[model samples]
Target: MARKSGSSGEKTRAMVEEAATRLIARHGFAAVSMRQIAREVGVQAGALYLYTPDKQSLLKDIMRGHLQHLLESWAAQAPDPDLPAAARLERFVRFHIDYHILRAEKVFISYMELRNLDCDNFAEIERLRRSYEHILEEILISGAAEGVFHHTDTRLTTLAMIAMMTGVSTWYRDDGRLPPDAITTRYVDMAFRLAGGEPLAEAAE
Candidate 1:
């Protein structure tokens, strides 16, 4: 793992988290051991406890980091705040496909390991995710009001969009025939077509 600039404490914690992410993705959370992760980071197994008091805390750290990125990435690149609802929704589809859905392993880890989080940690992660989804849901509803998007259950549409984006992780492979850009483009096209909100050509997959 690459090193980052931080206090010794922070650096160790970062390495610990990254090691766990790689392990959990290659093997489920249940299959991973603190000793294994410590070995990956070239540290004593007991040393990991200094970073995260328990395995559950380590899991929470992983979930929190992933969810924070998910929310922040969407917030950062979202379309113009004042744009028509459908336009915002269209932008969101493109961003989701290109950014969050593009990386297969990271996406896989985010979805599969989330259930491993403790209840309080899981709820916190869910709150962040819920906020992110609510933004898209509002855009869909607004698009419907503006007579640009097909009227449907916004909740269902939002959930479907998330499911579709998350599903890409399952099938997407680095050595796949298509490059990331091409893959995102194809998925963006598919998403709009399925959403019943025909996309502008540039936005089309």
Candidate 2:
């Protein structure tokens, strides 16, 4: 089926994506079906095709959308490039933890459903994922050049920092010991230490 248009079609498409993300996050990609997603969206199975051609496309779109949104959101509020690397790093750490904790379902599906995407889809998603990772990698590189960060390997540090922050989405709860602000503060401190940069004293306040 052709792609959809108009506000109504766009609204339904968003609904389908949301339902698929929720179901896939809960049950795993291999366990979900188009019919199940349709039911979750309150649409008939046949009508679901009007929004997406197949399950793989839906999975690909969901992951792609999540990563794209991540990049765009960061771009909107990212600290100035001329700022000290530590300051920029602090912003990245806080932004990542705060943004992802609220969308745990999308985060879960993005990581867990990669194997279900087709070759092209996988590559596209990987490209988007790498783009987001590169934002942090560049920060580490700048900090290293400025002698502010002392990591052994920027690439490894970048991956580790992202994994550590993203892991918050897996176990974070509204009723947890720390509120989101405190949790983000702690993660920001950890991120700075992981990158071999001392956390700004104010970061803990």
Candidate 3:
């Protein structure tokens, strides 16, 4: 059968994506089924096909959508390209921590479920992932050129910085010892130090 018509179909499609994101994050992709996702969305199994042809496609959509939206969101709020590398680096660190901290589920699945993605899907996702990584790598490179950051390996440092920041999602809680702003500030200071830039004198506070 064909998909539902109009706004209702779009709404269901959003519901499908949301339910799949939640369930896949909780159970892992291979363990999730269309029927389970549909149940989570309060829909019948067949209704799922109306939104996504199959599980693989749905998984692809979920991962791809997440990355695409990430790129777009960053683009929307990305600091001016002409900003000093240190300023850019600080902004990037703060943006990354804030973004991933709030979407821990998506962050978890994006990394954990890579093995389940087919070659083509995996490649595309990797490309997107690399693109996101490059944003920081470029800042590292520029800062190095400007003598603001001293790093022999921008790629290695970029990956390490991202891992450090994204790790906040794994352990941070809203009611934890510090609020999000405090976490962002601390991570920003750490990122500067990691990149071989000096931290603000007051940042240690």
Candidate 4:
């Protein structure tokens, strides 16, 4: 089993990582430092080490947490004996956009600070990310076989869709424009269009 940190240790780690994620997203990882995160977390510089052994370690943990949360969300959203893959595809795509929008900070941080992750850490994150992509790709392929959707390259489309959803986290500000659900719905519409699926209301017409 993974060794868990004490409550205080977990809380401090959360604060520091939250600060790091915000600063790293706003200012590139190259521009942020452990000292800066420590200051933002209201802790002495050296104290940051109590949670993370080092800067590289801290970055790895943050990324791991992001991926872990993602895996959990997928597990929740994907039903057992699920509906048709096309329907599931819509849920997956829409849910992803909603998740990233709701947790924009984590999404932004994952996008920007990925360069900071060491080779092994980066590989693991990519592995989990690809698992998500594969799910979408499989659904699209199934839809293609059923003649309900068309795609020349399932991999390319899946990556493109993920990129589109991630981009939402970059620009979506809760106070700036639409609510998260509306934003997600619009994105789902756009994704359907890109995947060659007509919007439901339009299909009915």
Question: Which candidate leads in lDDT?
Answer: 2
* Least well predicted 10-residue stretch by lDDT in candidate 1: 1-10
Error of 4 at 108 (Å): 2.3
Over 1-205, each residue of candidate 1 has an lDDT whose tens digit, in order, gives: 2234478888878888888988988988899999999999999999888888887788777777776776777777877878987667667776776666455666676677787877888888789779878987888777777777784677888898878876776777779899877777676766666567777687553
Off by over 4 Å in 1: 1-5, 203-205
List candidate 2 stretches off by more than 4 Å: 1-6
Q: On a 0 to 1 TM-score scale, where does candidate 1 land against the true structure?
A: 0.87
Candidate 2 clashing pairs?
A: none
Report the poorest 10 consecutive residues by lDDT, candidate 2: 1-10
lDDT of 4 by residue, 105-127 (tens): 77767766788888998998889
lDDT of 3 by residue, 95-196 (tens): 898889989998998889898999999999999999999999989998998998998788899999999999999999988999899889999899988999
Total colliding residue pairs, candidate 3: 0
| Candidate 1: residue 72 lDDT (0-100) | 74
Q: Give the whole-model CA lDDT for all candidates, comma-separated.
A: 0.76, 0.89, 0.88, 0.77
TM-score of structure candidate 3: 0.94
* Candidate 3 lDDT: 0.88
TM per model?
Answer: 0.87, 0.94, 0.94, 0.85
Please list the residue runs of candidate 3 whose C-alpha ends up more than 4 Å from where it truly belongs after superposition.
Answer: 1-6
RMSD of each: 2.7, 2.6, 3.3, 3.0
TM-score of 4: 0.85
